[model samples]
Target chain A: MATVVAVIASTHHPFYYRASTSTGPDRPPFADEWVRKITAFRETLTRARPDVLVMVGSDHFHQLWLDNMPQFLVGKAPFYDANWYNEEREFGLPRMKLRGQEDLSAHVLRAGLDAGFDLAFSNELRIDHSITCPIITLRPDADLPVVPVYTNIFAPPLPQPKRFVQLGQAIRQIVESWPSDLRVAIVGTGHLSLELGGPRQFGPHGPDPEFDRRAVEWIANGDLDGCLAEVTLDSLHAPGNATHGFMDFMLMMGVAGAGAKADYVDSLDLFHTMEAYFTWYPNGVPEVGA
Target chain B: MSRYLVDKFLYTVDRDPELVERYREDPRGTVAWWESERANDLLNCHSGEASTWLRFADDERDALSTHDYVRLFELGAHPFLTLTLFIAMFERDYEEPLGFQKQYAERLSGFTLPYPDIAT
Candidate 1:
């Protein structure tokens, strides 16, 4: 029997990717700091060596765009490659590859639907930076198999916080029912606090470290409701904070089960963009019984 | 508005009278009322001039709920108008602050607004 061994929620700041491979001196000193943190995190993931890595993150119109977008989508490919946006191509980060867990995707989707979740299934979907950046950080060579779950947290008709928690329960049921001998690690990549575009664009005003600290603290304490309550869609996007991606973290908490404990791994603030990392593991006693 | 005009606009077009009644009763609720009606028409309104109204209907029947319809109003409103109204509303009503309004504005600012061209 395989159990979800670890859950991680962190920011996928493009700045780190760019600075890691950039040629210019304009790259901040903090960029190097991020690389070091990423390297350390990668080593930690490698040591765990889970059979399957379930990643939850937001898609910024990479695969599905304005004309057509699904609220929730699961990837069903057996293997996939990642592409950098038009800007990041100059640095030559080779397209990362990952073995796909079609079985898990199918099971999760089926279980979710059976549990009354409305989700879109994708047999053919391209990997975007949200998935790739963390893949590169955690498994640079991309040897790990992955199950990617996308949330429309940044888009309208965003799933409510309560709904996301329900999603986590649904995922737990699916994982627990699996008849395979596989260990799974779940990773969520997005932001802690920071808005993009508008007056806060790459400025100091938009990144709310106070709220970020509170969120990370609640996760560490296993206070699910406290964390969820603090982040109304409005509070998450308050004037000083623009990053609306923490909903991925909420989903991560759901899958980790209620008593999962989190530890702050790293925090990076660059160009008014704040990125934080936390790793969660299932606690001594499960909150929900089978 | 006359009963005939109301019937023509409401019944002939299949708009919900309850929504129109709410719209007529509360000025602030009118936009939401119209949006709800428009979304209903968009999703279910069939062909002919009436069908154009149903363009926004969900492909799956069970997808839309009363809450979803309300969310569509909150999420789909024009950002500029929403922001201005939100700020005004927040200022007037300090106790029950409108947070989603701000969140919606922040989230949608990046994307192009989806206002349908009335002239078309």
Candidate 2:
């Protein structure tokens, strides 16, 4: 059986690509601190040394549109082209190509279905920044094969918050059941109190700093009951319009398992949104060679 | 009100560099042309299989044609789509980073919570 080496979750701020790379006059004042924090977060994945990554992220009206939106979809292609034209135009993100782990994708689809997920499968998926931002921060080399799982947090009438958690839990079980000898890491990205295209956008801090504080506590401590008790479809809007994306973090909480505190947890309160990073080593932390 | 169609306009225009420019330079003309030529065109389907019943309401058309993002917000157009497309077209005009975005936010500051339903 494949070993579940690590469970990781983060906030995918698209501007990080430009923020970290920009020089001198163009660079944001917070770039150095952001890079330092991301460097420490990157080491968490490095220590786990996983061979394959199961990436969970939400599509932002890119390939998936209102015409044919799926609540939860898995990419089953042999390769995935990362980033989009709009992402390039807006974020200055470089185009990237990532190899896929087809066998695992097949396993996930089959097992995920049997587990009652009704998961949608896409053979050709052009992933956006939700998955790519983590790749840039956690695995800059982008060498490991990945299985992209996209959830619908952007479109209306989305799946319940608990549904996302259930899917994450199922993914953990399904990955552990795989026949491969390779070590696998489940990494997902989400938001913490975000607002886009609304009155509260571009604030000095996330629209609701109080919510961000509580959210970070919930994820870091794996407090599913406390988190779910407060978060609902309608209730999410108060934090910020885009706060529903936090469900992705709830999904990661499911992968980390209830009451299982994260081994490493960190957060940075940036303008617009609160950036967070969490990692858990399911099979105990790995020892690094000198 | 065809919120979906309004979103489709934003989505289609934002993705195409030429359309973004055209929409920026000539909002009324672009909106008029798009309604006739591209509004009914099923995004993922062949042009021959276009939908016949997809057209924007008069108010929606005016909002989009005038680039009235505030009106679009009140009409419940998807905020993310509205923000992204508007940024693409107008962000370049601002001198400072995120200047347009902050101004955009300030313009919508009157809106309270329980924002216009974005459901389609």
Candidate 3:
């Protein structure tokens, strides 16, 4: 029997990617202070060494379009590019293999449907930056096997918070029923606040410190209802708050189960970007185990 | 305002009059209905306040009021519904807007509907 060992949710602002490539020594989003925090977070995930990494994030119209959009889409590729968005220039594309677990993708799909979720299954899905950028932080060598799940939060008629949480529960059930004995890690990427392609894009693309602190606290405490309440769909979809991805966090919680505890590693308020990162463990040693 | 007018409109749209009246008094309920019934297509429609309405679970309905319904109507609900229903009615009522007489012939475009298996 496989268990979900860890659950993580973090911000995926393009500025973070741009900061990683900057030549300047400024320590704003990618400063030494922030780098150390994110590196430490990644270290915690790597230490877990889950057999499969289930990534829940939003698609910025990378693979599908409005003419034909799936409410919930799953990546069905054997392997996908880890730096699909970084290829805008002369950057080399890095492909991450799934460690021979393509069957798990189909299993998850079937289980999701059994659990009453209408998921969009794609056998030939393309990689996007949201999935790739976080992969760079977690697996620098890009060798980790991943199962990417796409949400329609970026588009309209977004899944309700309850439905999103149910999706996570479905993922947990699916992974638990797998015949193979494996450990799985669940990662949710996006922001607590900070919307893209809007007037909020002035300088630093971060979120409000108070709200971020509250959210981080709730997640660390494993208070699913509290966290869900704190993040209203309207508040998350507000002018500057891109908290729609919090639903992903809720799903991660479902996968981690009720006993999971999270540790806040990094909290970055870079310009208009609110990049908060956390690492959750199922039954590990409690540090700040709220 | 009058029940007769409301009933007439409901009959025209083939919607339940009581449901329409309920929506007039509680737009959030209407939003919930839309989400539960047409979630697949509704998810793709871009309405700024759709998330707000969808987030309201059954438990939270007690907090909603008639003012919210009025606000919903003011916030382009009528236009949205009218446009959507117009499309439906047009497809239902008319054989063809442009007469299907002598056809403007052209080469067959090789486009095909997406295969259901490959597309989830």
Candidate 4:
């Protein structure tokens, strides 16, 4: 059976690439602190020393469009091209190509179907910043092969919040049952009270700092019941327009399992939104970090 | 009110560099041309197999033609698409970082919760 080395979740802020890379006059005053926190977060993954990564993120109308959007799709291609023209134009993100783990993707798809997910599979996927931001922050080299799992939080009539949690739970069990000897890490990214294209956008802090505070505590302590009780499709609108992306974090909590406190938890309050990072070692903590 | 077609215009224009420039430089002309020529064409298919019924409403047309993002938001066009395409075309005009974005927010500040239904 494969070993579940680590489970991680974070907020995917596209500006980090330009902010961290920019020099002198162009750099924002907060870039240094952001980089410091990210560096520490990156070390958590480095210490896990996983052989493969199962990346979870949502597509922002890049490849997937309203014509035919999938609620939950898995990339099974041999390689994935990352970033798009709009992402480059907006965020200054560079074009990237990542090697895919086909065998594992196949296993996940087969097992996922049997587990009743009705999972969608794509052979050619051009990923956006949701998956790439984590790669840039946690694995700069981008050496490890990855299985990209895309969830639909952007499009309307999305799957229920509990469905995301159920899918995450299924992924954990399916990966653990895989026949590979390699160690695998599951990493996902989401938002914390973000508002894009709305009146409350670009505020000094997240539109609703109170929601963010409660959200951080929910995830850090693995309070699924408390979190699920408050979050609903209609209720999510109050936090911010795009706060539905937090369901991806709820999905990660499912991956981490209930009542399991994160081994490493940290968050930074950024201008538009709060950036959060969490990691759990399902197996015993690696000796290097311990 | 064909919010789908409104989003399609924003989606198609935002992805193409030439279209973004064209739309930015000539909003009325671009909107007129796009409505007449490309509106019915299925994005994933050949032009011969285009859809015959996908025209925008008069208000939707005027909103997009005039680049009235506030009106577009009220008409139920997806907000994310509106912001991204508008930023691509106008963000460069601002002197400070996120200046245009801040201005955009201020313009829409009158809208409160349950702003508009974006489901299409």
A1-290: candidate 2 lDDT, tens digit per residue: 99999999999999999999999999999999999999999999999888999999999999999889899999999899999999999999999999999999999999999999999999999999999999999999999999999999999999999999999999999999999999999999999999999999999999999999999999989999999999999999999999999999999999999998999999998989989999999878778741
Calculate DockQ per candidate and list them. 0.03, 0.93, 0.02, 0.89
Give the per-residue lDDT of model 1 (tens digit) for A1-290.
Answer: 56776677777765466677655665656667878888867655665657898877766545654335687888889987665332143233456667899888888888888889888977777677778778878877777788888887654646787677778767766776777789887787866666443333344433566777776676666578787776676565563433557777777777766766664456665555666676765533223221
In order, what are the TM-scores of chain A for the candidates? 0.88, 0.99, 0.86, 0.99
Model 1 TM-score on a 0 to 1 scale:
0.66
- Candidate 3's C-alpha lDDT? 0.56
Total backbone collisions for each predicted model? 13, 0, 13, 0
**Cα distance off (Å), candidate 2, residue A273:** 0.8
Task: Sort candidate 4 into its docking category.
Answer: high
- Name model 3 segments beyond 4 Å from true: A24-30, A82-100, A203-207, A239-241, A285-290, B1-120
DockQ of 2: 0.93
Ranking by DockQ: 2, 4, 1, 3
User: Which ten contiguous residues of candidate 2 chain A have the minimum total lDDT?
Assistant: A281-290
Docking class of 3: incorrect
List the candidates ranked by lDDT, beginning with the highest.
2, 4, 1, 3
Chain B TM-scores per candidate, in order, are 0.25, 0.97, 0.24, 0.97
Candidate 4 differs from the real structure by a C-alpha RMSD in angstroms, to one decimal, of 1.0
Better of 1 and 3 by DockQ: 1
| Cα lDDT computed for each candidate against the true fold | 0.58, 0.95, 0.56, 0.95
